[model samples]
Target: MGLLMFYEYLDKVEQLLEQKKDIELYNYLENMHAADIAEVLENLEVEDQTQVFGLLSDEKATDVLEQINSEDFSSLIKALTYEKKVTLLDLMSQDDIVDKLIELPESRQKEIIAFLDYEDAEDVKQLLVYEEDTAGGIMTTDFVSIKKDYSIYYAIETLRAIAPDAETIYYVYVTDDLDRLVGVISLRQLIISPPNRAVDTVMNENLITVNVNDDQEEVAKIVTKYGLLAVPVVDDSNVMLGIITVDDILDVIEEEATEDIFRFAGTNEDEIYENDDTLFERVRNSVTSRLPWLIITIFGGLLSATVLTSFQSTISANATLALFMPLLAGMGGNVGTQSSTITVRNIATHAIEGVGIFKTLIHEISVGIFVGIVCSLLVAVAAYFMHAEYHIAIIVGIAMWANMTTASAIGTIVPLVFKKIGVDPAVASAPFITTTIDLTGLTIYFSLATFMMANLPK
Candidate 1:
């Protein structure tokens, strides 16, 4: 539902709760989506939140819990008794349960684990050992697989029995008796083949799989590249551990994109969009998130000021030189930002072509040359009309051309170097790139001005 409509419904729900209209409140929420219900619950007082939740059937309540944000999920769980918490946890999938457990304190994690059946607790424990950003961490052990020796008819029978709780039965995995993943057979392929044939004869032995430790971003890429419904996660020995669905991959894509966008804006911060957090908490987080970037920018501003101060004589001789400084620096920053943004995406998607770095550098610099020509012509014409100083106009044009080309080159090289050194290309950052190019921009403008001063139109 639209935000306005949800709020409108929430107002009525609140009025009903105020009047102790329990049945009416439940009936009002009955038809809403679980996500919409969760949103309304977030806006309610703790007592009302639990009261509303308690009205949901176990299945519906489990769906609501899945739909809520982790912070709200944790807060709601804290209000529950141990028995109630376990009842909800039991209804959750393996991945959802692991995710919820991660939000709790270690002691609380242990407390909740004590309530689980032995097999469920053991699976959650196993999943906890994987890094959160890796395939293993996000995978669920809810997939269905059968031994390669099973006949097609037998495989169909086995899948029928397991499909109820399995994550997906669209593409069933084929493992050996030892549980080593050997092949894959789609439901369509299995149904079309002779039911009396052995599954191995119909399965595709050539498979693509990810190791448990592979990054989640890599997992997303593989899934996208292959147009897969899901990808199997296996151990070093090729033993099937779990599977990552496309839905989970989509979450990974959203997370990585948001993180990169924040980095580009120079914040190195996260959690900027948790609207359900308290006003004070949000404000505090925003301040902390932006503080480090502000500090770095200050140092960068000082460095820029120091460079300008060193060119005191040039500025004194021609005060017009100071006016052109901002134009030169601004153009350089704009070009560098464009180049770096494209380069970072190329690095992330592994789409860097077979073209050599020198070829790539030349192409970017050529782009800079065209941009520089257009911008410098405008600046030269503006200088000539406003100040009527041929020497100043000429210097401005040359300075712009030089600074822009240098900015483009630096932008392309910096991220590539970061990638080579095991740093994320995203971390090269717009602030860092702009700061570096500002230093270059200033030095170029002043040096060209000094050269023209020494030799032109004395």
Candidate 2:
């Protein structure tokens, strides 16, 4: 719904709550999607959130629980009795249950576990053993697999019986007698083929599978590469573990992208998700994430100051030189940041490898030179008109060109180097590039001015 509609809904909810019209509120929420309901709950008071949640049917409540934020989920779960909590959790997929349980305390986790059936408890325990960022952690155990010997008719029957619980039936996996993944058959293939055919005859033996320990990001890449609806997860022995659906891959992509963005901004996922209630707590969280990078920039600034100090005589002789310093430094920083952001994205997508790295560097350098020439000409013209000093104009133009070209090189190389050393390239991007460019740009600007003023005609 539109923002205005949601606001109108919120006002209606508040009014209904104020009048103690529980049935009316329940009726109002009946037609809403779980996601929209979750959104509404987010805007409500904690007590009202619990009250609204209580009015939902068990099925809707379970779906809503999966959709709400962790804080609201925590609050609502706490309000439920143990039996009710287990009932709701039982309706959730294994991976989703594990995801929700992770936000609770250890004791609460244990309590919730205690209430689950033995099978469900075991599955949750097994899933929890994998790191949250791994394929095993994100894959849902609810996948349909049939033995290779089963007739196509029987396989369809099996799917009919189990499809309700399966994450996706679009691609049903084929396994050996020992339950090792051997082949896969899509729903389209299943329906079009002769029903009496053996599954092995129709199934494609070639499979794209991820190991249980593979990073979620790597899993996303494979899914996108193949345009798969779901990919099977396997153990090192090729035993079928679970399947990660396209929906989960989408979540991983969003999460990794968000994490990279936060890193580039000198914060992190924790600070982005932090729900501090007071201004002081918010300020403290902000400082904790941002202060370190600003400190690094401060030290970088000191190095820039040293360069300026060394060029004091040059600045005094042609005081006009200082006018264009900001332009040079700013342009260098902008170019460097652009190069670094693209390089980091390429690294994340595994697009730039050995030969590609050289190609990318060359490409960026060419672009930098092109951009530098255009920007330098404009700055040089501006300098000539403002100061009417040909020496200063030439100095500024040359400095701008050199600084921009060098900035591109630094931007490209720093991320590559960081990746080589096992650092996240995104985290090393903007701040590091900006600081390095600032120091280098000033040195270039001053050195060019110093040389040209001493040797060139005034």
Candidate 3:
């Protein structure tokens, strides 16, 4: 529904609640989609949110919690009593329970775990052991796993028996006696096969799965590459751990994409965009995000200044070389940024497939040469127009070509090397590209000037 309509509904519900017409308010919101109800609750004051939460049926309340983000849910987590929190949490899937608990402090996590039933506590604790970025962390253990010896008829019966608690029934995993994942059968396969056929006969042995310790990004790629509704996660021993659903992959994609963008833009994501952050808080965050790069670039500038100092004698002789410093550094910086941007994206999405890294590098070289030739011609023309020195113009032209080629190489290689070393490519790619290009481009310009003018620096 439109925000206007939702607001209108909220107004009517507020009136109902204020009149102590509990049944009327429940009736009004009970049938609404859980997302809409969550939106209404999110917009309400904490006291009103609690009142509405209290009125919701247990199932509806769980649905509402599932729809809300971790940050927004923190308010309710703080407001509810430990006992009330335990009840609501017990009703949630283990994945949701763990996610909510993570938003709290260690003390709160301990207390919440203490409040859980023995089995639930154990399950939640096991999930908490995995880092949040791993497939095991995002996966839910609430999936169907059946023995392969069972008949198709028996499999159908068993599926019906456990369907209520299973997160998704589209694919039923088959495991051996030791609980090792062996195969999977879709609901359609089970239904279409002869009832008396063995489960193993119908199940597809060729399966796609990710290890429990694999990064969530890998899991997201697996889902996207295979077009799966859910992918089974397993241990190194092939024991089924859980399943990551497409819905969770959708969330991962958004989070990772937003994170990369924030990194590339040199800012914190929530601090910059979140309205709830106070002005002071955003300023603090923004300063930290940008100040580090500014500091690094300042040092890079000093290095460039040092290089220019080495060329003092060359600049003193002609005075024309000083004018073209900006030409070399400016073009190199721009081209390097472009190259790094493309490489970082390819790395993030693992998009370099049939083309291969070698082919991609070759293609980048071809592009760099094309760009260099065109830009060098312009720089040569500009140098002649400004200095009217043919020799200086040729030197400037060669230097532009060389520096741009160097920029392309640095831009393409820095991010790839960072990825190899387990550093975030996005974190270093842009600044590194710009800094290195400027510092190196100056050396190129000065060296060319000194050699061309036959006036080497002392």
Q: Among these predicted structures, which one has the highest TM-score?
A: 2
Residue-level lDDT tens digits of model 3 in 308-411: 88888878987877778877888888888888888889988887655576676777767888899999999899888885588888888999999888888888
User: lDDT (0-100) at residue 216 of candidate 1?
Assistant: 94
**Consecutive 10-residue window with the lowest summed lDDT within model 3:** 267-276
Clashing pairs in 2: none
Q: Which candidate's lDDT is highest?
A: 2
Better of 1 and 2 by lDDT: 2
Please give the TM-score that candidate 2 achieves against the real structure: 0.94
User: What RMSD, rounded to one decimal, does every model reach?
Assistant: 2.4, 1.9, 4.0
lDDT of 1 by residue, 268-341 (tens): 44547566579888778778877787788889999999998999988998898888888899899999988888
Model 2 C-alpha lDDT per residue in residues 401-451, reported as the tens digit of each score: 999999998999999999999988889677788888998899878877777
Preferred candidate (TM-score higher): 2 or 3: 2
Positional deviation of 176 in candidate 2, in angstroms? Answer: 1.5
Q: Quote the lDDT for 79 in model 2.
A: 92
Q: Estimate each model's TM-score.
A: 0.92, 0.94, 0.85
lDDT of each: 0.86, 0.88, 0.84
Global CA lDDT computed for model 3: 0.84
Superposed model 3: Cα runs more than 4 Å off: 1-44, 52-60, 77-91, 111-117, 265-276, 353-355, 382-392, 455-458
Candidate 1 Cα outliers beyond 4 Å, as residue runs: 19-21, 78-87, 271-284, 356-360
